[model samples]
Target: MPPMRKWTINGDFLTLSPNGVARYGREVTLAIDDLLAAGGPLADGLEVTLATPVGGHDLPLRHIRTVHVPEFRRPRLPQVWVQLQLPRHVQGGLLSFCNLAPVAVSRQIVCMHDAHTWLMPESYDRMFRLAHRVIMPVLGRRARAVATVSHHARRQLAALGVAREDRIAVAWNGCDHALRWRASRSPRDYRNRRPFVLCIGRNQPYKNMELIWAMAPALAARGVEVLVAGEAGGAGALRHGPNVVALGRISDDELAAAMEAALCFVFPTRIEGFGLPAAEAMARGCPVIASTADALMEVCGDAAIHVDPDDVNGWTAAVIRLLENPFERLAMVAAGRARARLFTWRGVAETWLGLMAAADGVPVQAPGGRGAASAAPIVAGA
Candidate 1:
């Protein structure tokens, strides 16, 4: 029998607004919970608890326990809570899904999704960027292990001197959650009178929303509309034509509906840890015309029509091609669904379990039947 192992999950993400990182945390936690419930070699002698700050969302979990830690009123409540109070409640190994983790917890594994703060400084505020710059390196060096969403992210993290490449594991984000999004149940009618190419993201500079806005005129000339979703922070400054519709901050169902009705989902991100939005669109059966960014290429593979982020003409051409060719669209949808299947929450959870077991100095078989050593980084789907 394996020796008993106790691990605590840093559920700080539950308290924050739902984004890619928060979505990763939630989906991975649920996957881990499901795995624990279905006892196996991975679950043997393993105990997990989710520790969150007070007022975090209550997740319907079985087999794993949830504990709320009270926080002291501080300037940065979330950061202070995780750094000071959350560490005190950890039973053994701490698993933090989001980027930041307590530096004091030496026996912790943190999932630093990306080095975006350093890579794309313009997208983040000074304080947010500064905090990540200071904290990530500390956690990278101090934490027992580190996990990232993609090989591209792992490379970026290492190149930025955040962590050693050997210390970082790659666990790609799952796309199965998008499959659950009910397009038919969407509250808003996303089916615009004219066929639209859908784009989603905040107005962050690295998101490269400007490329889409630039191409809108050419696309609109072809009788197609450009639908921009998510927070339109600098909507006033956007140079889009009248055909560009800003659907600010939509729900998952609404996004699903938009994708289903759209000509193709366009993601022109300049950089990414893993392009979760493109992967999600693929899973939802929407053809993707994504950027040629390293992470996007890695995640989308040949499933998407890759275009340079700065190529306004190229993006416009791809959208038009998909709009004109029904056969090409159908082929892409099939290929995308197949590619999206490669990433799974259960697979990610298994990788996490393997990492935990190895961290505990226990020799265990990883998801692909490879032996996990304490010092070796485990890449999911490797």
Candidate 2:
């Protein structure tokens, strides 16, 4: 009989990149590790370790055990590392949070965040787009279970042509990090007297960075500044109008300061697995103006001023309206904070571990919806 599956997580994403996907892996893993240390009902019979290739990045592994596979340290083709090498090295069940899971592992769980490559093909490299198209469907089909960050993503997963679409279930991401890192003790001492609008995250194609830039001219006319922050592919790459200040890769505290000081937070992304920045901004009590498409609608819900991403006029109008109307902005802030309170790291860890256990053939004792921590229902304010 196949050695009674020992639980292991694919840790390649941790070492390879520190993108949004990798950050999710770290945040959720740490939260789970903390819960396991606390020794709850969910901890029983759960023997999970992070099986990883060697890398420079170090995680706070206080409660998490990690096994280093030395051969995988020097990187080769990532697919080969995952498909062939990882499976050969790791024994027992696998829980892969970042998209791909080894096909050879019969009992495994993979988190399919979104059908991004399908939704925005131009965003990725040619080789990556081709590989994802070929690989994702197979990963979805063969894996014992697939989890997505949002309910909206499950619908997108259906388009991937996976046979077991029924296995696609909701395992949402958390925004507690926003709470932890939010501007504290006087909103980071806002120095700017001018009212500003905030936009965060990288200048990726799907992010619709140009739309944020495009709004600058109109926003400047109304005496509002646009503070664009995040990985702009390196300094000096982005061009903004007279009103825009492109802050590249700011500290969380700085981001929080920006959010707290802003008149409104804008996210005009064409697509997202979950629009984390909007959620992050909401958690900070910043008024948000975000796109209605994909996961943003599910995430922001009634809290934000929703706009069609392609409608430049609509986006401008939303910002203009929010900045001018204090009642609307205050309403968004109150609703947004209440909405953000719904997603917690502790809840995320509980839900994910419950799902992982079920996937690994362990009997799950958690509640039906989104696992144990979800018992505290997300009560959105009116």
Candidate 3:
């Protein structure tokens, strides 16, 4: 029998609100569970457990154990638990999918999804930024390994002095979850609705939602409405216009339907770790007009019509062109689905397994004999 390998996943994300980071953690965890159940060399003698705070949500995992750590009642309980208490319950190695991790854990891998706290400081509140600015660098230096979602993000982390370039591994986020969404069961009936362009993101400054607001009038003039999803807080002020529908937070099924039926999906974010929404849009066969941000460019590649985030005119033109041109739209949808296929949850899990094994000083190779120490290479144009 192979030697026993024990690892605990930090389940802090399960207690947080659903977002890109949380989604990545949840999906990757599930994928890892699926891989273990499938049985393979990587899964051999591997014992995984998800350690969460007492009230964290549960996941349907087959091959991994789940434990809830008792937390001391305190301010910032989640942060406190992860940094102080959770580590006490861990046995061998730790895996943190979210950006924050126990800085003291030397035999661990923390997936810092982005360098947003440093690069896009204004997007986050002061305390949040300061916390990350301090904690991330420490984790980068102390952890056995670091992982990020995109090559662009990996470069950003290294450039910002968060981690050495060599210490970071790139594990791209998967889009296959969108494929599981049942568009037919979408709650909204779109058959009689006006032709609309769909946009989804929080109302953060870096999300560049203002650009969409600025172009809403022009899109409406062309008899196209704008459907916005996932906005909260101050975005309610922008929800007044008839041409713009603020779908403040929606189910995946609803989003899948919106993407499938929309004229196109527009993502004008100023920065991104992996541009997950755009990737998910592509996975749903939705043509995308995305920003030329480095990560977006890398993820969307030739699959999307790229535009400057601040270019209102360019965004308007792209949306209009896609609406009027069936051939171009069809071609783009085909390209997008093809591109999205290159990213899979299984691939990401494989990368994480390799990183974990390598970090633990185990001699393991990926299915293709790639050294476990070197993560999966970035997919072409991904």
Candidate 4:
């Protein structure tokens, strides 16, 4: 009886590395580690499908199940297909299950990263949006429990009537080993030979880069150049010639180096369920400047400079103020580090344990005062 497997991990996401590199890929590949770190009966019986190109080479052969499917395709169709197949292959063998994508299965748990499909419909093709909209609601209704990365996402899911409030759980994201490794390096050597403010993520419209670009003159006034990392989604080259250093796609170490050297991390996104890069920068002790979305505030706490993403003048003014005020910048950096300390993989694992236990009809303790210490601090004048 498969040695009473408590969890079976899907690793197809890791297999498509070149594509993963293209897409703003992060945690989908690290799901196995997250499962292992929870430290329960589940860890001992963990089994994973070996598909990651580089990492899979050394994994034990007996553990791998070669699910023959095209590993790469446009719009992540291959992953979608494989995720759909996992339910049948692992059905009856597990006491609990977790999928990173929408799937039909039992004793199931799924973590949907964001509802960007609704926010930025133009970023994806109609077919992709249709598939997601049609399938996710069904997946939400069928799953035993649902997990998300932010409270804003929880509210969005509830408003959509996607799932019951109790069934939906919030598991904040973590800063992985990569960021930690970079944190140990020298700031001058790591970041380019100049002081700059960093902005990370896809240069898509909903991310509100246009607003950031408009604020560039203001950022330049503070003697801080704006550096952007990640792919540019839409056509026609982005503006801000010499003032902005556009590092299109870079290695993990390079990204880490950039974050470490940054004067501050700025992210004035119009919408996001969880702000990964902003939180990551804070975890590495860099102050963050982001929009005042409920989700952004929730993740950043009192450690960030908040701005109205749509208000061009306001965003510009905030960037300029942070750059000029050395004392305020240092204070925010210290506060950001403290705020980031509260979010860790261990905490996320505990939240998952409680949610999964509740789903399994196990009498789990309620989340009383669990994350109270880390809730966002109040800002003066709203």
Query: Whose lDDT is greatest here?
Result: 1
The global Cα lDDT (0 to 1) of model 3 is: 0.85
What tens-digit string does per-residue lDDT give for candidate 3 at 131-218? Answer: 8999999999999989998888989999999999999988888889889898788778765787899888586789988888888888
Which regions of candidate 2 deviate over 4 angstroms?
Answer: 1-5, 72-77, 182-190, 233-239, 365-382
> Candidate 4's residue-wise lDDT over 313-342, tens digit each?
776666666667879878887887777776
Please, what is the TM-score per model? 0.93, 0.88, 0.93, 0.79
- lDDT-best of 1 and 4: 1
Candidate 2 structure quality by residue, lDDT tens digits, 197-260? 8887575699898777777788889998877777753455335677777777777887888788
Candidate 3 residue 38 C-alpha distance from true site, Å = 1.0
Per-candidate RMSD vs. true structure?
5.0, 4.3, 4.0, 4.7
Worst 10 residues of 4 by lDDT: 20-29
Which residue ranges in model 3 land beyond 4 Å of their true spot? 74-76, 232-241, 366-382
Each model's C-alpha lDDT? 0.85, 0.76, 0.85, 0.61
Clashes of 2: 0
124, model 4: CA deviation in Å?
2.2
| Model 1 regions lying over 4 Å from their true place | 1-3, 74-76, 233-239, 369-382
